[model samples]
Each structure stands twice: as C-alpha cells, then as structure tokens.
Target: MSSPAPFSRYEFMIAWRYLRARRAEGGVSVMTWISLIGIALGVMALIATLAVRAGFRAEFVDTILGANAHTTVYMAPQRVENEFTDDVYVVPGRIQDYDAMAAKLAELPGVERTTPIVRGQVMATANDSSNVAEIFGVSLDALKAMPRIVDPQTSQGSVEDFDKGVAIGAGIQRELNLNIGDKIKLIAPEGAKTPVGTTPRVKSYEVVYVFSAGRYDIDRTRIYMPLAEAQDYFNRENVADEIEVFVTDPEKVDDWTLPLLEAAGDGAQVWNWRDASGSFLSALDMEDDVMFVILSVLVLIASMNITSGLIMLVKNKGGDIGILRTMGLTEGAVLRVFFLCGAFTGIIGTIAGVILGVLLALNVDGIMAALNALTNGGAWQPEVRGIYRLPAELRAWDIFRAIGLSLALSFIVTIFPARRAARMNPVEALRYE
Candidate 1:
C-alpha cells in the first residue's frame, strides 16, 4: 500500500478529537481555551498599538506640512562696510524682486507652488483681550489654496474679504473674543520711522476669516493678512521677507535642497521643514520602536501558554498515543497530530484578533468621542497633545506583522511538546496504564 500523505485527513481528525475531549476525562480543554484567549488578546493589543502610533505620526506630519511651508528660501545676510569708519556690519538680508524669484522657484522639479511671505510678530487686541500673533502676509489666492487654511471641515468665514481685512486662527479669535467683521488692532513694536525715533505701528483690520489647522499651537497663534497690508504694516516695500515653497512630496524635500538653492540663485539660503522639525520626528520614530519591542514581549509571554497547554495534552494522551503507535501510526504522524492541535488554536486566535483590531481601528474616532463624553470632555486635550483628536490608522503590514509574530511563537513553543509525544515508548506508556 502507498504511504499516506503528510498531514492527512486522519491526522486532523485525531487532533480535533483530542482538542474536543472533556477536561474531566484527562483533556486539556481549559488550557486550550486559556492559550487561545491569551494569544488573541496579545495580538489585538499589538495591532491596536501599531495603529495608534501610525495614526499619530501621520497626523503630526500632516499638520506640519499642511499648515507650513515644505521649504523656504531667504536672502542671505549681507556684510556692509562703513567707508569712513573702516568698520564692517552685517545687515539682515531682504528678498527684493521676490515675485520674479517666486516664479522661478515654482518651475523647479517637484516644486508645487511658491508664495512670497512677509512675516512679523504683533500684539492683537480686541474687545478687552490681547494675545501675541505670528502673522504671515500671503495673497488671497494662496490663502485659498493653503490646505489647512481653506479646509472646509475646520475653517469658518470667507476668504473673499481677505484682501479687505485679515484671517485669524480660531485660538486667537477665542482669546481676543473677536468674530468675523469685528475689528482687531495689531500693534507692531518696530513701526513708523520718524526724524526723532521710530514709533510702534498700531493698525486695526476686520476679522474676515477664521481657520483651525487641527494643531493647537498653529491654530492658537497664526494669522494671515493680505500681502500688501502686511508689507505696508511691516515697512517692507517692493520686497519679501522670504519665499515659502510647497513641494510635491514633503518627505523627499532634502532631495530638492540643491535644486532649490540653484534656482534661488546667489544671496539666497534654503531651509526645509525637516530642518525645523527633525528632532521631533526622530523622537516619534524612537517611540514607535520602543512600543513595538514592548508589545512583542507581551506576545511572547502569551505564546508561553501555548507551550503549557500542548504539554498537558501530550501527557493526557499518552495512553492513546501508545495504542495508536502499536496499531500502525508512525512517529511522524503522532508529532503532526499534536502540532496541528496547537497550530489550529493559533490560527483561529490570530484571525479573531485581526477582526477585533480592524474594527477598533475603524471606530477609534467614535470610541474616543464616547470616552471623552463620559469623562466630561477630559479624555483628549488638544492643547496638551497638539492634535485635535485621537487618530488610529490600520495598515495591512502592521496586521500581517502581528499575525506573523503570534503564529511563529505558537509554532516554536509547540515543537517541544510535539517532539516529546512522538518519541514516547509505546511499551512504557502501556505498562503505566
């Protein structure tokens, strides 16, 4: 007769019979249940952690890129020599002919759009409230195109009146108690120049728009004004402080540094978002690695239950194994049967974990909202976390990794008990009975 194929139907049937046996009859049913639950919980926890990490990182980076420039080109500082005193002084550079330069930079590879910005710090006061604001001078067209500023989900008011007034962050509006069409006074410390000295420039503009960038700091402190108004307010005429460059891909910004510099020409310096936010991104990456290591240990611990369960099953079935071996069962068949029992538990557990994790990830926002409501809106603080909401993004690779790790551990731990069952002496096992 031909030898039976590996892992035949009989092996699976025997494994199922052993798994279903009653605990009172020397069965390991309780241990099997415990092992399955443990593995499932561990896998679920790992998947959830990974999803949160990914979502947090993505949201953080998205806010950064959307609300700010991917890269900025500024005029390099120039050294000026005093002819009479024979002394040298460094003067802050200004980007004159910025329109032409912005147009040139927009043509470079991977360059999305370029906007000339006049930036300044000023005190905003309205309705007996005052706050410091970092103002960016941008064209109405650019303001409308900006991702965070024009986002319908978070922004209120209209940019049509932007040229006639100013757009303020939601935080600033709340602090100053200002609303659309309300006048807000901006006090610039370095203002008009007179014969005697300079005076602080104080001007009032109507709040034409309000926006939320989904970031606490940005939404709290940023303001957008018309380019002409900002230029006049900041005493910059026919010049720009810097050119903000958006790119096709913010992550590959470094690759465009040289090209941007070349396009910007001499007396220009380049700075990218990475230069400003690299340390924070690195910290996030470190946190992700640490979390994965910690959760992997949890999975390993849970898989230990599988080893214990399989060992008990091996002991309880010793008599059955001796009879089967005497009848005609091969040692390999005995090992396969026991291995199938543990593998089946792991497979089912991993599938259940994946389902649970995906469901949780998909509903994370609703769950967080419910939790926050239960805690009286204390569960999530945007100011503390720097994000408006808790985010959870389920990635296919993360789920696959969780499944792989759990199954690998289960198989490894099951080996020892399986080998022990296969090598048992039929005569000795029968003698004990």
Candidate 2:
C-alpha cells in the first residue's frame, strides 16, 4: 500500500522536532544542554591530554637524538670490581679498528655519518668547585655536524678551537663561574695505578667554547673535547670506546640496527638511543595510558548526565509516546526516537570538543609562552620548573578513539530510558491526560 511510510525519516523528523521543541512544547530541555556540555568538556580533556602526552614523547625523543647518536656501536660493559677501591668499574668494550668499522657502517643505507667517540665520565673542577660531568671525546668535524651542539655566535670559539682546549656546556660555566679562558680540570679515575695509591688521571683544559644543548642535564653536565685529546686523557690512544652512528630517521633505528651490527662483526654491539633510555620512555608511555584511563572517567560521568536527561524527557513526553504507540508505532521505532535524541547530544558535544581540543593543542606552545611571559615578567625560559612547555602532537587516531568512545557510551546510556518509554502502557499513559 502506501509503501510503509519511511520509518527512518519519520524517526529523524520526530527526534528533531523534540530536540528543537520549546520548553512548553516539550522540546529540548535544560538537562539535555547540561548533558551536552558535560560530554563536550570531557572529550576536550581527553584530546588535549593525549596530544600533550604525544608531544612530550616526541620532544624527548628528539632531544635525546640531538644530544646522543641514533645508534652506538660499542662493547658491552665488562663489569669489573676494583680491588683498589669500593668503586665498580664498567669499562666499555673497545673498538680498536673503529675507523674501518665506521667506514663500513657509513656504507649502509640510511646511515648519515659515523664518528668514533671516547665517551666517559670525568670529575670537572672549576672555580674551586667540582662536579662529575659526562664527557664525549669526538672529532671537531663531528661536533660541528651536530645541530645545536655548538652556537658560534654565542660560543667563544669554533669547534676546531676545542682541540686546543675544551668546550663545556653553559650550565657548567654558570655553575663554576668560569669564563671562556678559565681552566677546568678533568680527572678520570680509571687511570694507571701508581705508588701513591692509584693517582687519578687528570688534565687541565682551557674552556675554549661554551655550548647550550637546550637540555637542562646536557647544558649542566656535558663536555666535548677533540677525539685525540679525549683519548689521551683517558689513556686510550688510537682507539675509540664506541662508534656513534647518525641516521636520517632516529625513530626508525631498528631498521639500521641489524645491518650496522652485522657490518661491525661479532665483537661490537649496536644499540640505539631508545635502549639507553628505555626505562624513562616506558614510564612516559605508562603515564600516558594511566592518564587516559583516569580522564575517561570524566566522559563516563558525562554520559550519566545523558541518561538523566533522557529519563526526564521520556517522563515529560509520556502522553505523546502513548499516542504514538496507539497509532501502531513499533516498540523499536519508539526506542529509536529517544535513542536518536540522546545520540544527537553526544555527537554534537564530541564534535565541538574535538575541534576545541585540536585548536588548543596546535597553539599550546604559544599559549604557554605567553602565560610564562606574563608570570615571569620576561622571556619564557625553555626549562622552567624543570619542564619545557607542553609540546603537543595531535593524532587522528586519538581524536577518533575519543569521539567513538564518547558516542558509544552516550548511545548505551540512552537505551534504558528509551526502552522504558517504549514499553509504557498506553491506557495508563493516556488516562492522566
């Protein structure tokens, strides 16, 4: 007959009518707006938090890569107990033919460059103050190739100049109150044992350059010296403790891992920056996941508002529902009307929140800079409160998951109220009217 009136169209029209209805006409109510706002706020929190976590991870990875090599070909530590002192020595396995090994690694695809490095820790003394600093004995050419490792304008001298002396981090200079020409002593304890109960291998170096590595730890406690000079200081002449491998993509370190290790042969072990900082990275990921779950409670709480609003709407529309049932509206159709109403609130809220969150994430850096400037009354320090500003990376999947989960929960919450409305007794519902 009349081609069973378009049920879907009828449901949508009825749902929209109810949504747009005035308070007197039983249209969308105050509860619905409250529920919508709640959902919106929750979704916004989720997206923003996820973006920030992503951003922090990305920034950390880049910083690590900048300060360290993408991959290091080194000997695994052969832990040896020092008979002279309580200190335990972790001597790295050495690469005697590092030059040839580096050349071989450089031939591999994706390898940007390879540099032999003498890496160790040394006690640095300046201004009569002493602190242990991480040291990298690297070629001046290699140091020059590293981005942000040296800033010539601010630096007192060039990388080549470091061969005659040493380049220290700005933090070191500030802490020791030493100028470019001041002398700093670097003492390596793993030196030759003399009659004087193991004399510390020590060298006095002129601070020829000052570098700002953009990382608080690096700026405070990292030093670079000419490779040959470092070798002499550590008593490892004509040998390198490791071969630092730089690659095009630090994130894809695995791709080059096996190939590089294979080229280096059996004695050398290849590891990436991630391996060196696995614990920290794992903790970051766990923190992000925990935050997501904790923040999701906000969305769940918001969905309860949808349930409350739907129940109230059904109660107010009992008479209209009675009439629809009497006119042969199926239970499923009746359920869908209220379902659509609640779903509409969730969909709108999710969309709005996602847009707001993304916009905030994209400009978070600038926002933080302005806020910091206002508070500090000056330029924003990159490392204020021991943290850089929120570095946000918004991902499509994160947004999609947030919206999907919110909408699904919203849809699920509406079912109870919709079902109750659909099952109402028409006679009793109409008797009151």
Candidate 3:
C-alpha cells in the first residue's frame, strides 16, 4: 500500500503551529481569553444545574417514599370496573373484605410487604382539649416497618399501647398538653347498627400510644393506632380504607401494576406517589427542564467565544494556509485544521469546568455557611430550623450530557469558519498580504 499523503501532517500541525504562535506572542488577546473563560463558566453552570436537579429529585423522592406507600391499592365495588380511580367517592374508606383482598395481593409477584392503612377524618381531644391531628392506623407489623412513627422519643411510651387504643402525634402532644397516662378522646363518624336500625354513629377512644414520623406534619400532628382500634373507633369491621404495597423496584410500578390489576380483577386500582403528588413532581421536572434549557443557552453563548477565537485564528493564519494549499495540501485538510482547534477548545473547557464544578458542589455547605455569615452577620446556622444544606448528586449521565452538548456546540461553531478557510483561493489569499 502507498503511504498516506503528506497532507495529514499539515492538517494536524497547522492547528498546533497556529496555537503555539499565538501563545508565543504573549498569548492571545483578552477577548480570546474571555471566550475560553466563558466556555469554562458555561460548562460549570450546566454541570451544577444537573447536580442540583438530580440531588433535589433524589432527596424529595426518598422522603416521599419513606413516608408514603410505594404502591397503593384501593378496592373497587363489583359494579366498578375501573382499575384505578381518583374519585374518593368511588372507592370509599370502608372497603369490604379488605383482609381477604390484602392476602390475595400479597401473592402477586414483587410484593414484598402489604400494610393495611385506615384513613378517616376525626377530631381528637385530650380530656376536653382538642387539636386536629392526622391519624394513620396500622397493624403492629406495619407500625414496626414505619420508621418515622416508631423512632421518635416518646415520653408517652411504646406503640404496643396503640393496640389497646389510639396514639397522638408529638405535635399534638405539645399542642393538646397530653402525657403518657392522660386520656385523649378520639371522635370518629361512622355507620352502626343500633337497636332500632342502621344509623350514623360517633365514638371515642382513649389515647394510649404516641408516635412521631419525624416529618413536620407527622411529628406534630400524626398518630399511629392499631388497625383493630381504628376499626372499632370508626365502627368499621371487615373493611380497610387503603392497602399500601411495598414493591422491590420502585421504578417497576407500571410493570407490577398491570399484573396486579389483572389479579385484582375489575374493581381494584393502583395509585403511586407520583400520582398522589403530581404537582410536586411536575414542579421538580419543570425545574430540571427549565434550568437545562436556560443553561444550554448560556453554554451556547459561551460557545460562541470559542467560535470567534477560531475564526480569528483562521484569519491570522491565512498566508500560512495559502502556502500549504500551494504545496498540494487538500482543501479538506485546511478545513480540519481549524475544526480540530475548535474541538480542542471545547474539550479543554469542559474538562476544566467539570473539575471546578465538582469542587464547588462538594463545598456548597461550607460556601453557604460563609455566605450566611458574611451576609446575615452570623445570625444563621445550618442543619437546624431546616435541613440547612444544598444537596448535589453528580450523575454520570449528566456528565456525559454536558460533554456532549458542549462539544457538539463547539463542533457546530467550527462549520462555517472551517469551510470558509478551506474554500479560500490560494492566489487570492496570498495576493492580499
């Protein structure tokens, strides 16, 4: 085989020689430096944006999953054919044969745990003292699984008392002025069969156990009681308001839901946290998308600097390119000279930006602390009154995307300038100088 044309050396060396010439002349102009700086900054911002979105999404989702059920199943009547329903009226809290339904669902694939949760609106009181507290009635097994409720320090005592009666939230405890031995009256509206006939009923249970879920609403106003206690208090039997299912893979809800629905047959429905908290999830998605677009625009603007620098370099090296063209270098080789320079600028900028971005993200807590001290006159402290930290999760995919976008932008800017340099007439180019 014949050796490759000498044009290959010229193509590669042209960009290198031009860069060295610029560096030797006390480096490029401030504008060229500024372009490189802009590119670097743009990439940094993009990386940061991705980290913030990923971090926040992961944290919030974890919290939601920690408290809320991964997959919830609501029983439907025989006449009800829909698999899922948002209409609370369609699937009432008093679902018949709930115990039997839970057992059947447990047999389905991917079913790790099933917890029967009783949800009812009730006004609670502590010996004439009253406060609005959310009561989540769970069986002893489910209560053990619920870390938030079972873990908080309780002066009032253990959840075993809950099986005897109801437990109030810590917030309610502070608000309603309750103690371990104190009796809190639980009033729930229900339907009961009286001597005369079936009628609406109201009943009260003493507060025996206190639980805190470590969440604002829960710690302050949530109570966990025994499932049986809730049923008796609500005058409900052989009925469960909702069944919470814990699945192996959280992302595999759709895959599990289809089969679960088939097994559940006509009346059963599935509700995921994504469905329950669509607004929050939507906002999270919007934040990520909006930031991505905005940051991409910034990168685009920054990318232009690299473009301008390359274009200028082409202009400066016109005479040299003309000589090479006269020496049998293909126009294609000349075009690649500038194109490689542009690509290198993007690659270098992206690499530097990533390093700096990671450093900033890692030190955000310290940075925030410094800013708070400087601005707030040392009036602020982190990790109390709130989480007091900015979170960032550096995802590999995000890095890949950043590199792709930045380089793609860099390569795109090379097109017109590279083409112009390659298409120049050697005679015309040399005649000008």
**Full-model lDDT, candidate 2:** 0.84
Could you tell me the TM-score of candidate 1? 0.96
lDDT of each: 0.90, 0.84, 0.72
lDDT of 3 by residue, 194-232 (tens): 898766545555667666443445556567777886776
The runs of at least 3 residues in candidate 1 whose Cα sits more than 4 Å from the true structure, single-residue gaps closed, are 25-27, 80-90
Residue ranges of candidate 2 with Cα displaced over 4 Å = 3-10, 21-28, 76-92, 148-160, 178-183, 190-198, 255-258, 366-387
Model 1 C-alpha lDDT per residue in residues 32-79, reported as the tens digit of each score? 888888888888888988998899989999898888999999998899
After superposition, the stretches of candidate 3 with alpha carbons farther than 4 Å from their true spots are 1-13, 20-27, 76-93, 123-131, 147-221, 258-269, 279-283, 326-328, 363-390, 428-433
lDDT of 3 at 374: 83
Give the better candidate number (1 or 3) by TM-score.
1
Per-residue accuracy of model 2 over 92-155 as CA lDDT, tens digit each: 6888888998999999988999999998889999778988798899887898887767666545
Displacement of residue 272 (Cα, Å) in model 3 is: 3.2
Q: Go through the candidates in order and give the clash count of each.
A: 0, 1, 4
Q: Which scores better on TM-score, 1 or 2?
A: 1
Best by lDDT: 1
Model 1, global lDDT: 0.90
